[model samples]
Target: MGQLCLVAVMVGALTLALYVDAGRQAEQNAMERMRSLAASLAVNPFVIDAVQSPNPTALLQPYAVDVMDSAHADFVTIMQTDRTRFTHRYPSEIGGTFAGSIDDALAGRTVNQMQDGPLGPTIRGIAPIYSNDGRIVAVVSTGVTVENNNSQLLERLPLIIAIAATLLAGGAIVAVGLRRYLQRVTFGRGPEEIGQMYAFYDAVLHSIDDGMLLLSPGGELVLHNDRAAELLGLTLREGVSAEHSAATGQLPSELVSLLASGKTVENEVVLVGDRVLLVSQRAARTGGKAGSSLGTLVILRDRTDLRKLSSELDTVHTMADALRSQTHEHANRLHTMVTLVELGKGDEAVRFATDDLAQGQRLTDRVMESVDEPVLSALLVGKTAQADERGIELSIVTEGRIPSGLIDVHDAVTILGNLIDNALDAVAEQASPDDRWVEIELIASATELVLTVIDGGPGLRGVSPDDILRRGYTSKPGNGFGRGVGLALVTQAVRRSRGTLSVQDRATASEGARFTVVLPITSDANLNGNTAPVTPTPDRKAPQ
Candidate 1:
């Protein structure tokens, strides 16, 4: 609408100007024609002879009428030096005084002016007729009336209309084109609406707690909030190109890949420094599903703290479930021993109880001696019970004492716990329960700690190790809601600790997989580990 109004104003102004200019040109042409006709008559030899004769009107009146008709002028008058008309368009008024100035004509001059005359208002030209002796004999005047001038101006009306129509059509086309362009660019928003939208968007972007990134189609950093900067550990400004950011090593390779792929992903775990972020990404389109790609939008949620809490909660639940199973098993054994003693089989009851005590005691003592960290020891104990409940043999072996503060407790749990759970799940799939087994090895050296979990079950079976490590890749069949992500979590935790993880077919077992992780733990002075690990109270009733 604004465009249309502007075009209308412009066309109207231009048309008015053209009309005014045409009127001026028409008036000029009329005046020039009249002046030329009057000058030509004043120089005619017949008019010069007639003007000096005794009866000049007899010869001049008819001649003046003929000239007037030929020149398309309203009137032509021949007058004396004293301004007495001798010849005129009206024969009866031939002797009447000419209603015009002839003083200049009498002074041997030619004049052109708009003046009131016998023919009402007119544009007239006057010229003096001089004898061969160069004395003024008479004057001739020719004019076109105001009405005739108007008729001449109307003659060019069609051309003026054509020009005006062309201008209007051109303006409308330009206006429509501009309107469509603006609509596409601005989403049909006016200046004020666009300004308001910008204000609202800025407020929302800054107010959001989650890290947000807006990229252009070319992957340039169009916008990023403060939270995004803090989470990504990047000092960024607007308009930073993607190449420059990647070259500067500010954006992590995972994030750069996501941006480049232009694929939509949700809740993807990305490890940046020591932070674990759950990133959600989608491509932004301008209009709708069919619209062109605008860019990719990424939202990052800091899941570091939540993951730690979840890890701890999972450990507690595992311990509780394991303790419950142990309680039930012990109760069943005690009942059997009581029945044996009641049946006078005290020797058998004592032997059976002693055997159970010895086996449980040795395993507990081994784990405590190998792992000084209480959380890991407790985790292993609980996992051992869970394995026994599922009829699978679980073994935990260690090369050296894993002292406290070797690695972050949460990272330790996320890595070791998930690996064990994954292994247990894998081995539980074996058809022969007696042949199923999972083993854990924690080797602590002066410079690093290596954790390995092996499972006896169907191996990778030609599946890529890298594919299994990606999120949402699970061998187990189900609804697949939370099917895959254990290994991904492990990967993220391993990366956070500046560690490495690898998966391969278990060489010891014909159909099993082995996973290994190496985490650096140099020294107290050089280590960039998290807070010191905390010791938990061990199960006092374990075979004691």
Candidate 2:
């Protein structure tokens, strides 16, 4: 509305100025023509001769009338140097003194002016008529009435008004169209509402823990939250396309693939650099009934910590099962002893109880001797109990001692725990439970911690070891969520510790599969004061 008002005001002001200027121009042209006519009449021999005659009015009256009629002038007059009229269109005024000033003409000069005359306001031109002797004998004056000039201007007024109206109409139309376009772009919301929504969305996008990326349908990176840029190690910019990032190797190829596919991806686990992320994607489309594709929204959740927690949870559940199994077995043995005592066979009960106690004590003592790291020993003991419950024989071989803090307990748990668990699964899958067995070797030295696990079960038939270490690669069917991540988690931990993992198939199916992991343990002195020795008590509650 303000724009419209401004345009209207400008048009009106411009038109008014033009109108006044045009009127002035028209008046100037009319005065010029009248001056020319008066000069011509003043030079006429008939008018000059009559001006010198004794009775000038009678002879000059008809001639003046004819000149006025031919020139379409309002009036023409012939006057003497004394300012007395010689000829006038009004016959009664002939020989009367002229009412208007003609001093310049009387003094042998021509002049023009807008002044009051017999015809009221008029543009009058007066000129001197000279005798044959070059004496000023009379003056000729001609005029165009102001009323006629106004009427002429009015004739052209409609055109000027039409032009101004056209321009104003065009401006109004354009302004209205622009307003509508802005309204649509803003979703019919006012400036305040749009600003508030923008602020709110900005806050939500940055405040969330998960990473988010919005892309156009053509795979251009439209928006990315701070977390997404940090997580993916991306330096985002406006209008940077996904293909460009991929070509430059700035963005992961897997994410680029999802964006280009334009298909919804749900909770797909992908390894991005050293971090594991669970990525989900959805198509963002217009909200209309016939929805058009706008782009894709990619959501990334950093599952690195989550995956670690899950692995620790798995170890906890395994220990819990092992403890429960041991408790059940101990309870059975205790019941037997109690029954023996009730039957009055106290001597037999004592022998049986001692034998059971000695066997358990020997296994613990052997594990404690083999590994000095309390966490690894405790993990092995729990595994031993778990293996016993499943009727699988478990053996541990330790060739070297692990220095205090050489290997982080959590990393050890992740590496050894996963390998041992995979071995146990392989052994338990065998048809003959009697022949099922898992063997583990922990060899720690000043340089590295080498762990090897061999399972007596069906070998990894024709499967690549590298393929097994890949995320989401699993051989067991119906193992569910926690099945495939164990080996991948172990691989991640191993790589972080600057370690290497290898797989070896046994010579025969009866021998089973062997897996080895060698993790380099940097010395505390070489760590630049960044690490200290971890010496926690040997307990099941220790973190893996």
Candidate 3:
């Protein structure tokens, strides 16, 4: 990460330096050309216009022969203060407005290149034609064509390519070297298999499924495939105008600030009329010096349809769970009625059956009443069935609509699955048969999505909160790498969602554990895209 950051910073610094140098050179060139024109006019006072229409022979004879000098600009125009185009460069510009820095110069400010103009849109400076008493006579605006702007673009093109290409090429070369080194040093790759062991990542970069980008640490465009440019609203042209926009604009400030502060940041920047790009980046290095590598490959995944499909998938699972629970709940009620029929206590059994059925229906009504997210509601129903499967009573005690907007269907299902899995894992560990149960309470208020998963098992013991979310820390015996990645994955997933997850001994129950997860409720206002802070809320719980 540090290496990637450093490379990005260097690349940005170099680009800014190059731009400054180029801009300064262009400005200097404009001034020199202006000075030369003024000198020529002083020598022959008969010359006035900029295109040299009248000759030296006419200047010698005619009293005040107004001659336009030879000015090689994209477009040349002579206009009055009211912005009338006198004699334009192109026929198209004959009556166009001189509403640029030329007007400012007529009003006596040393204005340089204002807007698009004729030698095919030029960069120009205006100097007033002065008389003996310093009275302004006319404005002598000299400009070089914007078609000439291509020179600047060409000069810097190689540098842009070098910066972008270096990072990608470095990654490729380094991977190969690393693979070979590991084979030689640590038996990580076998002799026969090493040759066959190929680059899945090489294919990943070229895959058309998603557009890929490699960004410099400071968020400059680095290596991007053709698809990336299309996604990012960048030009398909390698022409002058395209190059101008590519290099001269101010970069997004938030991105630069993130990199400078040594943080790996990822977010979506809209392309105005293009795809909704989900840009995911990690701090990585090409592991080379300046001019040798560009740091950080930023991958852009087109998740528009993928996201919709994922949401649908989650909904399906939630509905399935809900259906399973409904089936089990009905079966249990019917079994009780059958037992009563065989016992011959008809009147009491009938009354008891009615009461029991009412209680069951009330539980269903209460669960279904407040929760509005159909997918989540279904998931809870399935979770109830899962509880029955494990011989434990599980219920969804939602106080309000399943926290709207903050979580999409997919994330909701994921959370539900993790909570249930953790509860099951806890229950499996309980040897003492006292209160072998699990409960999940989901409280959705206007402010938050509060989920509490409680299980009556050996309460989380001898695990430090600081280390609980680490990649490999598990409470299960043997410290084995094999069987303990589930809880860790859940922790990381929560962290990714910018939410908080905490585990504790159940507050209301003594013999079980409770994991409380609070995610800030997202409204429709913030839910249309990826505008989020990915910082994992520091586990504030003191170590147990």
What digit string (tens of lDDT, one per residue) describes model 2 on residues 1-544?
A: 9879988998999899989988998899889999999999999988888888888877988887888888888889888877888777678887688878888887777889889877789998999888899888778899889999889899999999999999999989988998899887776888899999999999999999999999987788899899998888878774878989888887888677667877776766566777777778898767663677768889998878875676577668778987998999999999999999999999999999999999999988877765667877778889999999988888777665655577777778888888888888887877776548887777655566678787786777788776676544567785244456677777777777888988888744456787878888786524332222333212111011
* lDDT head-to-head 1 vs 3, winner: 1
lDDT-better candidate, 2 vs 3: 2
1-544 per-residue lDDT for model 3 (tens digits) = 4444555666667666766676667657755665455344433444343223334223222222123334444433444445555444444554567646555556655455635644445666565554446555445455666556557556776876586568655755666677678755645756566545445545555567666655554445555566666555554333222223344442223223323444443543322222334455566543333334355655665544443454466557646766676677668867877788788867877887789778767766766675667666667766666666666656455555553445765667666666676676677666654455667777665556677777776665766654454322345675252333444445544665677888775444444667777877657533222223233322222112
TM-score leader: 1
> Which whole-number lDDT from 0 to 100 does residue 262 have in model 3?
44
Mark the regions of model 3 whose C-alpha exceeds 4 Å error after superposition.
1-349, 395-406, 472-497, 505-512, 524-544
Off by over 4 Å in 2: 1-160, 164-187, 226-235, 246-254, 272-275, 285-293, 302-312, 328-370, 391-399, 422-446, 452-488, 500-517, 525-544
RMSD to the true structure for each prediction, in A, is 7.9, 8.3, 25.8
Question: Residue by residue across 1-544, what tens digits does model 1's lDDT show?
Answer: 7777888888889888988998899889988999999999999999999988999988888888888888898999989988889888778888888887788888777989889876779999999998999888888999999888988888888888898889888989998998899888998898999999999999999988999998998778988999999999989766776767877887877677666777787877666776767788998887787998878889999877677777888789889979998998999999999999999999999999999999999999999886777888888999999999888888776776787767878878889888888888887888876548877877776677878887777878788886676542577786543446566678888987889999887455343888889888764733224222323212111110
TM-score of each: 0.68, 0.63, 0.38
Clashing pairs in 1: none
lDDT of 2: 0.79
Poorest stretch of ten by lDDT in candidate 1: 535-544
Q: How many residue pairs clash in each candidate?
A: 0, 1, 17
